[model samples]
Target chain A: MGTWVQTMLVIMLIHLTAGTPVWAVLGQAKASVEKDRAAMGGQVQSKLAPGYSVETITVVGMTIKEYVSLDGTVFAVTWKGTGVPNLRLLFDAYFDEYLDALTELQNKKPRLRRPLMLKTENLVIERSGHARNMWGRAFIPSHLPAMVSPKDIQ
Target chain B: MAYRAVVIACLWFVSACGSSGGGNGSAGPQPPNVLTVTVGGSSVCRIVNQLCTQVTICQPGTSTCQTISDILVDTGSIGVRIFGSVLSIPLQQEVESPGHPIGECVSFIDGSALWGSVQLADVVLAGEPAVTVPIHVIAPTFAGQSPSQNPCNSVVDSDPRTAGFNGILGIGLFTHDCGISCEINDNNNLYFSCVASTCGSIAAPLPTQVQNPVWLLPSDNNGVILTLPNVPAMGAPVLSGSVILGIGTASNNSPPPGISTFTTDQNGFLTTIYNGTTFAQSIIDTGSNGYFFPDSTLPLCPMPDQDFYCPSAAADLSAAIFGVNAGRATVPFQVANTANLLQTGNAVFNNLGGPSSSFDWGLPFFLGRVVFVGIEGQLSTLGTGPLYAF
Candidate 1:
């Protein structure tokens, strides 16, 4: 029985060690899985969302520098773009970072091993302040319209 | 349930953010770097045989119908999909003018069913008018049910405010809400269908139908353009201006220059290029949430055991734009992992972007470049010009 329990369930670790409330701990994890059921229209031991997939759109009226700072790893990025900014439509990066983040939590004690939702929207830009500010690609200059006509198609 | 409400409130906050900064006129007028797409070729779509319009699609006094003026134009989708919440009763017609309510369950890429009443509407574009068009009443509002959706990813987030745009007037080269293909299984599920303008289950083996809204409209059925300006490398901090809705043609449109260019695939798709990668048969879709691809150079998200092959992490890469007859351009950017991706956490995401998927650029990709889409038509009057510029 001891060997069997060790191989299959990790929840036992929480009850035996963390000395935490199983109901609240398991509740959040269940909520995450239930979301897939909600998506499937009904239930069938569903695990619909394997990972996080998100899209981010950052709108701006002024040029602002983006930087990331932390204790150990210093990931500093100075980005300024006149041409369309990279929306990073790739969901892969997010899933990787998020899943890694989740894996760490999942590996921990009982209450910590909960499923999560990767719900992040692009940082918002409320209104265009004014037209005085210019919009164009930073370095390229071919966008000049030649005032051509519909007859030019020939 | 209360927690769901809280989540919904948060979702609204996020949507408000999507529409704000981009609309501010603070940025000066610069011709948005336009990508000209050719719009000339012919595709066929059968009008739904029996579906009702605005009729029965009402919260009672909510008025199931509104003039075409009230409709909003959306690019995120290929064709038109009207919501039931906005229609007026007088405008609502009976299903097939005789039979039952046609119902359908639309599945977004996020994998969720938007079950609701389905009907048709008379669409008037430019000046012409179609008597009855199959318009979807997506919201359960007509069914007397409050909205219930995954708050964080609902369509409302696409447009936070209802200021100018109301219902969608999709004029993409294809259809919106891709009728059935996005479904996981069981073809005959009628999520959004019509028996006679009323509602019915979708026909068996749902078809990934992408109806072109312009074709359904009474006039200017040719094609459309989305023109805006280009932003510099250093992005603006605020929103820009109204997204110009037409090519510079008629009095309502502005024809700047260098816009008359394009090529077409008989399959109703256009040939496009990005970062030196040329995709010959790419559909002009606005409804997609992000740019998607599995280019060899870009990093791939390693979503564990998922079919999408999405990497769990975003890859940062730089590539040049190729295949433009006018001139060539080089640009550098990062590709992030989107949902339903492939792989397990970190292992797969470490590799460069997918070498599998045909490249795709979603709404985010449109933000900076002025893309021209060529729609197929008489090839004579409907000459190849990027019908869209942004």
Candidate 2:
């Protein structure tokens, strides 16, 4: 199965079980703003760009912004909040790959203790925060639409 | 044990010298069981605020021993971990399952982890000898032997160049590195048993876990005392000290009357209240170069230096350290602009700090102070184990 199909299946499963369409952070189908507004229990707003649309959701004590391609795919996710959201829940199936990449990053810089920035063939992640205040951004490099830069994910 | 304790106590008064100067070059009745700690000595890699000591290792129990210098003395962690590339002599590898060697993935608060194998070696610290204890041998090859499913297999230091030090001597406030967590849980992922080329995550029994060689000592095993000379307000190129093994067991390491003792929880964490915010999981980590604490008032250095705080002026801050009990201490610390400090090419700074989740009283906090690390489940004159006393 294609990566999108597998991710779509996982999203469908989560929606079916939880009665809410949960969008994966980096690689799910573009979210239905109405469903997201209800599922997250917060306000949902969006802005359409030339090639992609940016949807912002404020909920769970964290503000998350998702970059959606015109064809309907969440290519990136950025979040800022008091505490880091569980990556397993945020990235879904892609969490394992993120972890693998993180390990490789540590191997390269064994003494790097702060300001984590990771870039892999498939993903890009940056995390920096202090106590009770955490923020980060993660994006699927291949899924990012044309004219949309990874820098825009932030 | 009681008879030995009695003998040591009697010798403390008879053999103890009254010299106040305890620098690395102290000429006053140097004990045979002692090691000199150079804060910023002849280490090839000049990482700032590092407390380093010399260690002698041998193949289990042989005449062959190599005294390796530049071993970082860390009170924040437990056990001895040496890079495989630095080892001149080979040690016997320990196995968990039949014909399967034990591997470990050690994680730090910084989100960095090390993948390595556990080997049995006779580790000599200062003049104390610990026979047949499990130690970590960091190597990228061993990481491949571990199961792919294992979380630690994902992270492996490619070479010793990135490791900074020859090895790390973790004589923290614990007996074992992973302790009961890895002992009872099979999925802890810290420990693994490799059969042939396939390694699987398994529960590492307490006896098989990487141990604190200090705890395995024949005498003076209660704890350790680290005394580093005072660095100037600006910074210093080099500083020196002594990492005396065993607390109260040795005359040179006994805590003075009214010595402040702050206890820590299972993970070696205490509480620190600074700037009206209470950081519940504060740790005194000598492994960390600077005093890492979160303070919004202090400006963060731009981009690459963002990990450290960059104040217009060196900010002198105070925090109250609260123990598990009612024990409390108010400590005054400083955080200087790391970028400007780096310009001077100084390796030891008294006012260096960084940004971290919780309060990390790092190596800078150890300067000019005699710090005692009380090991868990052990007894010292300061009361019980698992306490940081100054």
Candidate 3:
């Protein structure tokens, strides 16, 4: 039943984006980049850090960054700009859990103006900013490598 | 372009007494000067801390009109938006170069989103006729668009039933929504043009895009003043107020000499310093229910109510609001436990607040005050466009 529930969760999230898992190969992340590039316009850019690398794909009005471990596994995603990117595509399977946590938060405190900080057991999603200058990031906490801190994703 | 303050006040008093329920009225003597806004009046859709008003939308160039009630009045955003599910009139859709229907994905500060198509309508607010402006008719399935194709994260599903409000009327201090961003780039994703069943992002020209209906009025188009009576610390079951149109144009709407005015940036952001920390992008948004700003000392309600600040007792706090022109005014507010406040039948409270990075003076801040929002690039006695005065 536990596996069934997990599978059901993945199925619901697949309705959003491809049910991509964390710690996936760099090749799969590139495929997502290609798909996103085809869907959303703009050039794909990259930046190398000490223990990890970030692939930034710039769309028409926003840029999305995918943090990859030194071992080439995509671990996290972050985005900011005038327009909001397709969050469904950015977080993939993790988006469902994020939505659940967000629903819980909103139900508790409806009509809040704060930037959202949704933390589940395995994922942490933080989004802030008013219209036109919106920004947010999502990551799988358990999948992060030893050297990479959560702040590094941003 | 100013009218006598006494004349405005008389008209406001007469109109307040005349209009009992909601209906479509004219733009003659009424001047659209005063509109009654109710907070938490609907029983079935008992949305807490909600500020709502009645909006009468008409078929362009025709008398065929429908008055929509429970429309959420929001200052956090700009544009007169309605849900297609509640719209009875068949308004014309705005199309792009390729003859595709224009669609929009409006995202909110809380991470929720509204997906819809842009349509042309004559919006009548109070007694003003904002003629032939682009308004968003929120239809998630517009042009047979599927849920997967929609860009927004589906929190309320863009449905009024689930969202607990009829629609949103965003009259923030901006002339246009998304502004030059949607005009210059197609990839912004806020505006889209649909060919057949597939909608793709497209650059919407300024004239054709959604506009703040308040800015397009023939007369008294400068700005608006939202005046709400003070609610008790324990909260009230229902709250009533008025959104007076124009600033300094009429006596009742004029900014008093003692009133503090804060100028804003192009994005309508002002500086708010809380706990000695400056948040340059703060805004006075009536759309937000609580006074939202992060504070480490205040405790949060357990489990579900954790989104709001819930001290054991009410906490009095002070914050300085700064303008881009170096003007500043300090404001004192309070925050109480959300769980305790919810137990009461009252829908309005002046002391409710929550945790947020930006200092959001929500509906709670409007109680016992008259807040003015001057339109961008428009001239008023208060000064020029894009100013907030209280």
Candidate 4:
């Protein structure tokens, strides 16, 4: 059927270096060869074609269950890198342990307040080593990539 | 020492459990080594699916950043959904298992089921960094229900500007949601089962739905490479680029220019042919915004439900290059016409994910374009295999 759909994606990199769990991949790529300088820090000097500076990392001490966060851009900045973000964070952590009693009746019902008001922020990104830290995730682990074990899977 | 024992096991690990990130990246024989990160967007027109164009994101805590306009940058379902009950950062859903509440019963292509929840945030993507991952919050909606179920009822269709798109950023490669088959095959599959009462267990599929997060990237997990700007007369304007992450990491990502690399069979699905229709599978999702298939006949776009349209009509969108045997040259688009070409309906306007058979080119086919998805078993000196290209 297309090779049986390619045999379900033919696994085994140790299934990802022995099936993940190294510090959860915290970071490693900065070997000091130093060579990422695009004229060192944008803005004071203008347009060499500048456009696309997005960054939203937050997985260290997670907190964003259930769903619905509107107003606009509901989805699609998706530059690439899948696992759909980690299957949407394992379905938002199994829907935050199963929607805690229907959002706790919208958080203990005050006539179900209106106009959307949720404030539980904690998305501090900047890690690498495969991302599993949370000292506020400042992680500059060197932009990740260097754990290739699994008898070297190639 | 082991990188300081993973920062002392990230403070006794267990924390970052699931808010987002992971759908399929990291299984191997080869494949991994990709990092192309590109951002800076605009294309506005959304009036409930009339001309859509967006990519703004700012809700880390919000002072106002919502514009996720004509999104579709999916890698096949993982996270980053949006539709609202009230927002800026008010979207919630929770419940992975305490009683199973994150609620919702997904399975679109317009068959209808996309309930909601399994959400969590901190996913800012532009040049790579903002990472809290776990996303899904899709929203055809629910709040007492009534996001309105109209096949063409409201007209622009799924509404969000005629589904021209405002949402869909499934950065492929794998990490969560059905990847080991929802954690080791259940076969009932709602991703393993979930229907209502906040949703949970009722499915029984082998691969009916749940398949994109872009092959799963720890670095180009495998298969992608869009690249556009050809214009061909504004026919490809949904443009943008830089999802180069992994597929053996660089040498220009190797394998290109005609499409057909084929590997995924065990559930990653990739049967090939597209545009002329041969189909066995087709999930390279960036969260599907186009290239869906099903049919009543052909020349699609007409809805009430059921129409991948391939009676043979085909016209409106049609292309098929895909390279694997020789390596690289993707194209793989369709439904420009020819019935049943890319099936699925309920008319979110179009593209729900093809009639059971599979053909999800989503990510607005990678707007502005510059695609190169590879990672599934990497090699890359320009060989081995995975796909997508410009």
Candidate 5:
């Protein structure tokens, strides 16, 4: 579909679910992709591949992409651009788990200022970039489509 | 009385002429535009290949200056950010209203951030005239709120020891850190106005934003030339270089002949084609410790340091770099086993590399080469920047 039409549909969907709580994309339903865009206040563009679909949102200097499986579950999300997107909204229920792992990693390696590669039991988060240009991806191993690989998220 | 007069005369002569031109025959004064940069070597910065320098911060309009060392020299970012713990003198905080002070959250590619308040100060770089500009003071507890509580939720360094450097001096290719984006978008998430303990994102005008100290220089304000000596494959424990302010504006900073200049996009990004894939978000940053790019063929290190590559032997690699102006250059680089290099106890390496999402020519790329960073919208002999010439 056209981008303008997709954006309008996203906006209308957001308006319909205006009073609902903010939706997180990772491991959530595909419908939450529009809610994530609304929470970010960005424009949305959708594209379909073989077994999954990608929803991209552009806000300010950042771009976020949400990958949804054929079963309508968000399996992974990738972000790139100036600053990071709101991970609290994107990671949804998994935000605290990610934070705990990150804190543990920081405590272990106090002085290393390199790219982050955090892997928990079920969730994997990797970020790399510098100031003004940052990018990263978060995904769930079990939630990925059968035909999809982690490398395909980007 | 005569003995006293003799003693007084001797003291006068010694005080007036004892040390003038007596130290070394060929040693002359250093150029005002040159800032000596060091990697490791007695500096408290312990990270491998981390570039360090010193900057003088003074209270605005006053000579109450404090010079802090171990400040990271980062060409990947913009603006001067100092740790508040090392600052002795107080600086005027930038505010949007009577009760609200401006706080900033600068996130890095490493998934870490520096949270602090913006304050105006007289920044002295090398021997240049002090320029009063806004700078980020690294204070995670600014206004009694932590980074997690603030809008930007990321891993924030609380002190210099954990951060590996005293602060960062971002002499990149821009005038302001956020530039026009923060000036227009209130939800930019970089700048915020804090009241008591509550802070909300606010649109910060250009004048109030933290600025690149090099841009405010009276002359030599165009850009900087960072030159580091080449390191051997075995690496070195310490290395030294120079960051010459301005481009072609001084006798010391003139671009050498037979140089390649490539213009970047507005966001300071060039394109890199590696392994038959075109990565458009490539960047040259001294802040990154080593070359970070994606290559599935290279094996990764074991746990704890798995973020770095652990190849069996030294792997030779090459990539083609493309600028927005259709300028292209082919560059060859090497990636060695990180475990072997780290065990050598060397702080500087030209072959250390790791895995990353984009093609980042980190400090290793600056070695044995004189790279010039032309600031955006600034004119120089290399043409108007944002361009990188080497």
Candidate 6:
């Protein structure tokens, strides 16, 4: 099969399998954070900070943090560990959008190998680090709490 | 022009290059311990500030050897990974049991991963004795598995053109890529056992995992000393340096007196105090192309180069680095507008930088410095392994 066809089929498969309960926590209700913690089999520790709450999950050499607004809406997610966590679970409905943006960025001319800083109309994702030690954060700018800033997510 | 004059003077007065310089002097010929490293200029590495070196790999114990160029000299990762397309010799595939071959998925901070089969080869660096060790041979279709099945769950580089280098020689602080973590946990998402057309996560024993070839060398196995000359603030079309194997094992690799030493965690992370905030996960990595740290004050470059900083003018900054052993050093660095630097058509810059969650002293930091990397558990003049000295 052609490479493009294969890529499309893979995307389809990812979309089909992305319907599990563990997905869609990024822009979902606060309850989805529990599903993510359960799916990842990690212990969740929530901390309240003025206008929002931060839910941290530590699992198998990786740490995942979920930021929820005062209204209980998940706003941003961050990860750091030996390897990248499953983005399909972290990005949820926005997973495909992330992949699409990445493909576009990778296809650019004068191809440079560096950290990724992906900014779309609604989401902003920044990933950096090397092997064995990696980290990144993603957030929906529109969903951020009034007093919370992007830098606060980290 | 001044930098060019300095280079010419160094060539004439070799001793003036200092003890860290890779000069054989009047002694016979080029030293066996020194491997010439270059950035740009005739190297296949097209990316700016990417350090490239030559590596020799042979089929285990045979005379069949192939010397590959454009192999990245990475201090942020472990083990040697080569693109299968660039490898000409047939290597022995590492097997899990009998018919099950071992496969690995190594992910970089750039969101790209390499998926391939584990193969054993006789790896050679500079004039060091060849070490027989397992290495990762990049093959996207290994074991009939598709890219989506990669344990990294990320896009895999299919060839050297897209990846920008033929392979990477990861001589980091760790001896093994995954180390004890992979040995004890099957869910580490690094090692896999391929049976037939499918691969599953597996807990690979330490011996079966890909190793840092430096650790397996008969001599000069302790660590390495990387030396590169300083570049002007604007940029340079190309730069040359040396990757001297072994630290204090030979006279040429010995550490100079009064050099500060900093011990790092198992994952090679130190702490950085920048802008009143403490970033405890800071690292000094040559693999990173530029200095990366969070600086809300610096504006980012426009699109295409948006990942890089684009200060209106040059911005001089400093950060305090604190090692786990209480070794403290304040480092001053610069950040220039990427738009202006790119206009120079130069491949190297001392002031190139970007934004990151933590401080990353990248290739730019190696300029004008002779950095020592002590491997884990190994002892040298700079103390024990898992330490950085400059």
TM-score of chain B of each: 0.50, 0.89, 0.91, 0.28, 0.92, 0.92
**True-vs-predicted CA distance for residue A24, candidate 6, Å:** 4.8
lDDT of candidates 1 onward, in order: 0.30, 0.70, 0.74, 0.32, 0.82, 0.80
Candidate 2 C-alpha lDDT tens digits along B91-145: 9888865767888776554445567889988777654544568999987677454
TM-score computed on alpha carbons, candidate 3: 0.83
Docking quality band of candidate 5, CAPRI definitions: acceptable
lDDT of 4 by residue, B145-210 (tens): 333431111111233333334455544433344343334323212332233422333322213233
Write down the C-alpha DockQ for each prediction. Answer: 0.02, 0.09, 0.35, 0.01, 0.49, 0.35
Best by lDDT: 5
Per-residue lDDT of A5-90 in model 6, one digit per residue for the tens? 45545654555577754544788987777666656656778899989999898877678899999898999999887677778778
CAPRI level of candidate 6? acceptable
Chain B TM-score for candidate 4: 0.28
Point to the candidate with the largest TM-score: 5
| Per-residue alpha-carbon lDDT of candidate 6 for residues B7-42, written as tens digits (9 for 90 to 100) | 112221112222232222222255767887889864
Clashing pairs in 5: A129-B109
- What digit string (tens of lDDT, one per residue) describes model 3 on residues A1-154? 5764455345435533754333222224434554454456566666788877787877655778888777666778878777677676666666677777777666553544456777887687777655556677878777787888875776
Tens-digit lDDT track of model 5 for B25-115: 1122657788878877643677889998777777787766666777899988889999888787789999996758999988887767889
Q: What are the per-residue Cα lDDT tens digits for candidate 2 across A1-154?
A: 3764455456555666887455355677664433444444555667888899888877544577778898888888776643344355567668778777776655442143444556666787776432223457888889978888865666
**lDDT, residue B6, candidate 1:** 8
RMSD of each: 20.4, 10.3, 7.9, 24.2, 7.0, 9.3
Runs in model 3 deviating more than 4 A are: A1-40, A43-60, A63-76, A103-114, A142-154, B1-31, B146-149, B153-158
On a 0 to 1 DockQ scale, where is model 5?
Answer: 0.49
Question: Alpha carbon lDDT of residue A22, candidate 2?
Answer: 58
What are the runs in model 1 whose C-alpha is more than 4 Å off? A1-154, B1-73, B86-90, B94-98, B122-132, B141-167, B175-213, B216-219, B232-284, B295-358, B374-390
Order by TM-score, highest first? 5, 6, 3, 2, 1, 4
